[model samples]
Target: MKFKLIATFLLFATCVTAFSQEKQAQKSEKGLIKISIMYPFAEGKTFNMEYYETKHMPMVAGYLGSNLVKYTIEKGLAAGMPNQALPYMAIGTFYVKSLSDYQSAIAPNRDAIRADFANYTNVSPVILVSEVVK
Candidate 1:
């Protein structure tokens, strides 16, 4: 009876480990969908980079939860031409396993997320969704 119990325990552990590894492998194999939110730069336009990075992004990430692989924020420094104005003030990007995951996650929290934009910048955001290929 003790030997049988030990065997059962070992089997269960092995199955759990195998399942975990399979899940990890599948995730690594899949292509990630990238969502880019760009705020174009304009004369006299106001942007609160600190609030966007510190407060707004964190709130949105919470809503994204486990569906979000990761997120990043970029502040534009200068344009390609020397002494020229930047094309965008800032850009925010996030990655997810699939477009479906991002859609489902954003659908429910869309309102709250949009409402929070006022605390950050006045420029309207342009969105781009693409599959990451390397």
Candidate 2:
């Protein structure tokens, strides 16, 4: 009976240690901060994809400096429903090391960035900050 009890306790301890290590590994594998800009589609709105890709994004990247890991711009194609309009016209995403770092880098450039909107689309962008977990 005592031998059985000892084996059971050892098994429990091993399981506990393995679970802890797995959790730690998952946490370490999580990715950096992701800042997403989603521009909802609306009628009578115009977007200059050329200017956005060629000029505005590069200027923004320059402002982000070392804080920015990478950035991507996605143009809206078609909606999931056939013949349905797209939910968003464009999406721009920025991967950064930290949320605070991104905020600090963008703070001073806010006005300048907003002012440059005239060079691109008139759509109001929705912003989302998230921790990438993949």
Candidate 3:
């Protein structure tokens, strides 16, 4: 009887926890947009990784506020083979929860952001956006 009762209680607790988590997810904001920018690599062209990672991104975070959910930066090491030239210099990914919020917050600062590109790299960044499915 004791074993059966403990098993029943454990099952009930597990179900309740799962139900709670599902409800929480449902209540949270739904839209998540991912923006990826790939910067082409060029011989002798420069990218200031230190300034970008330390200064520019923090400025972006200041401007975007709650709209910017997260972001990541990746440096291109090689194209494929060990000796092959790199196809891209860097890649940046930014996640925003709402499109409207992003537009409102970032639109005004677009020129400033563009200008800062010179501080980082000579290559123009190719931008792409994607919506999270789920």
Candidate 4:
């Protein structure tokens, strides 16, 4: 009975690990990662849109080169429902061709990129990486 339990546990662990690896493989094979950088608003705090759009993004261009295929910027005006405040002050989507390209482009300039954040907004940004299926 003890041996059977140990075998079952091992099998479960192996399956879990395999599933996680499969997902990782799929993400890499897709060859596209959407890097989302978003800043949420706080009362009395302002988003320095001028600096972000004009300065920060341009600086990023120096590091990415051709790896960054495209990008989009969004300004939060209002929420869908009345009396609801906008969740984010702004959002920037960076479309990376591949995971390796994203890593190579970002690794060297990570510090400089993060340091520039203070120039634009007080709120710390949230970053999310995802691959699009559709």
Best TM-score among the predictions, by candidate number: 2
Residue-wise C-alpha lDDT for candidate 1, range 39-83, written one tens digit per residue: 999998889999999999888888787888889999999999998
Local accuracy by lDDT, each model:
0.89, 0.88, 0.83, 0.84
List residue ranges in candidate 3 displaced over 4 A.
1-31, 81-84
lDDT (Cα) of model 3: 0.83
TM-score of each: 0.75, 0.76, 0.70, 0.72
Question: Over the stretch 1-134, how does candidate 4's per-residue lDDT look in tens digits?
Answer: 99999999999999999999998867664656788998987897678889988999878866777877677789999888999988899998887777687888889899999899889888888889998673
Worst 10-residue lDDT window for candidate 3 reads 23-32
lDDT of 2: 0.88
Q: Which TM-score value belongs to model 2?
A: 0.76
**Model 4 CA lDDT for position 56:** 92
Model 4 residue runs over 4 Å out of place are 1-31
Worst 10 residues of 1 by lDDT: 24-33
Residues 13-86, model 3: lDDT tens digits: 99999999997765552567877888889888889888888887778777889888888888888889878789
Ordered by TM-score, highest first, the candidates read 2, 1, 4, 3
